[model samples]
Target: MIYIFLAVAFSVAVSVLLKVARSRGIDIVQAVATNYVVAALLAVLLLGATPEAAIEAKATWTPLVLLGVLLPAIFLVLARSVRSVGIVRTDVAQRLSLFVSLFAAFAFLGDTLTQAKALGIALALAAVLCVLWRPERGATERGGWAAPLAVLAGFGAIDICFKLVAQAGAPFASALLASFLIAMVLCWIAVLVRAATRAAPVTARSLGFGVLLGAANFANILFYVRGHQALPNSPALVFASMNVGVVVVGTLVGAFGFKERLAPVNWLGIALAIGAIGVMASS
Candidate 1:
């Protein structure tokens, strides 16, 4: 439970840091790129991840490459979502991405489609609509829906890629490290391109924030993994607690800490998201 709490805190802290980064005019791309540097180091030092495992004969390169591509891309989208839609919607959208993976499980992964899972998917779809709702000339910035919706889909795809990597027999930590290293390379490419084009200059400040973001991001994964290891028999419990905890904590931080406003429908969406997770977990 303490691990779950820490996981939730670090998860929300990532969004908070993104929000602050935007406010402080930090180069998000550079910061995110540098984030993978710290994350990869932690994976090696703490998780004992090694690249050799990822390069073994049984491992597949396709999913690893896809994960590498999607990780930084989705991270950028997540930053945009947080900047435009605020933490509340972005976090809910991210958690609800399980629906995408759930669909894939039923359609492609040969998982049985149970009634509870079906109901959970329905609830999640409803939650997406409700959470993304913005009244005409509302408080939310214009085009706010785009980034969060992208977030929902992007994360869903990343989840599928991770599943593919697992099915390929690549150890989790190794796959993670490989993906981070790839993402770091790709991110730096983007940063250099932007700098060359005079779009954004790389700065020490962004790198510093990147280190913090990476620490929080890595801490989130570390604690969540520890929580699962701590309660190996209760995977559903850990999954439910982690998802529901992020949604609840993110909402509080967005509403009070950041003063992000939400309509009643958005509140309904949050409830529905939690209910959906509970249903899926119970199923």
Candidate 2:
């Protein structure tokens, strides 16, 4: 129960951090890379002298190793999509990844697909559709298939990597640590390449925002990892709940705190997300 609350809280924090980081003129890719570096460092400090132990425990670095390539690749693409597609659309596309992940987990990994899980997955789908439903006059000046399409692909890939890691015969903590490390290295390389291509000025404002992002994002990942470990059988429904929580919080913060307006359908989507999460968890 506590794990559930913590996971929701972590998702909310991530929402807040993303907005704050953007406001400070921090590049999303840079911010994400910094967060991964921070998360990797924390994992190293906490798990010290245990690489061999962790690797031995997992025996198959397959999932974590794949995450190394999968995370940075999609994340960079998602960052671009966020700017072009807008947050609402991007969130919807990412959460719609529930369908992709649930299918993969069921077909390949044999994760539980009970009625309760299906109900949860359905609610999650409703939320995604609602979030993506643009009002009649809501179209932006730009309309391109590239960004949204790429974001969807990126999210689906991420979900696949997560499901694979979950199915690996290893301690969840070890798998998590290895995955973070791999992601950290890949992101670092990306950051260097960006630095060489163009000078991204990291002002005090950017630095401060990155640090705050690192804190919240790392905390989010840590809590999520813990909740994943505590939850049995690595149900895709649980991950669906995580995405639904993000939508709920993002909508609330956007409406009240940020004064962003929502159409009627968007509001319905928010309610559906909450209700779905409620049904999925308490059933």
Candidate 3:
């Protein structure tokens, strides 16, 4: 439970940091790139000393590569969604992505879906729709569909890929190292390209924020993995707690801290999402 709490706290912190980035005039792409570098360094420094298991963990490369490519892309989409749709809706949609991973578990991983889980999925789908619903307004004023859709699919795919790596017997540390390493390389290329072509300034602020972001990001992964390890027999409990915690925490922060407005329907959706997560986890 402590691990789950830490994971949720770190996860919410990441979202809050991103939200703060917008007002502080931060270059999020560069910050994100630096974040990857920091995360990679931390992973290597922390886990690099491990012997046999770390050396043999290269077998997980396939999924690691996919994860590396997806991580930055998804982060960008999440930022865009937060900017366009506000954190309340974006966080709900993001957490609701568990529906995709759950479906994949049943379809591809040979997991049986009980009625409770099925009902949870149904309620979750409804929640997603309600949260994303926008009242009729000027076309220019409304956020479009693309960023939210990308957020949904991107997170779902990432979850499925993680499951694949775990199923392939990859040591979590090794897999984490591989992912951060590859993502760092990719981000370096991006940062360098922008520096050459766009002359994007690299500021001390970006590095500072990136380091904070990196710490929170790495902690989120580390703690979530630790939570699963601590309760190996209760994957559903860990998953539910983590996701529901994020949604609940994010909503409060979004509403109170940021003063983001949510429609009554959106509020209802959030409530339904919590219920659905509970049902799915208990199933």
- Find the candidate with the highest TM-score and give its number: 1
lDDT of each: 0.92, 0.63, 0.83
Residues 29-119, candidate 1: write the lDDT tens digits.
Answer: 9999999999999999999999777857344588888888999888788889998889999999999999999999999999999999999
- Per-model TM-score on C-alpha atoms: 0.96, 0.74, 0.89
Task: Determine which window of 10 residues in candidate 3 has minimal summed lDDT.
Answer: 47-56
Model 3 ranges off by over 4 Å: 47-59, 136-144, 230-234
Q: Rank candidates by TM-score, best first.
A: 1, 3, 2
TM-score of 1: 0.96
State the local distance difference test value for candidate 2: 0.63
Better of 2 and 3 by lDDT: 3
- The lDDT of model 1 is 0.92
The digit string of per-residue lDDT tens for model 3 on 166-237 reads: 787876677677777678889878888887887786778887888898999989987998899999999989
Model 3, TM vs. native = 0.89
Residues 1-283, candidate 2: write the lDDT tens digits.
4665677676555555564555557776667667776766776676442445446645356666877777666655655655554555555566565556665676777777888768867877777566556565453423433665566666676767666655555555566667777777777676678777786643456556555666666676666656677877765556656767676665666567756557888777667766665665564
Model 1 lDDT at residue 26: 89
**Candidate 1, position 186, lDDT:** 91
Candidate 3: residue pairs that collide: none
Better of 1 and 3 by lDDT: 1
Indicate which candidate wins on lDDT: 1
- Ranking according to lDDT, highest score first: 1, 3, 2
Looking at model 1, residue 31 earns an lDDT score of 94
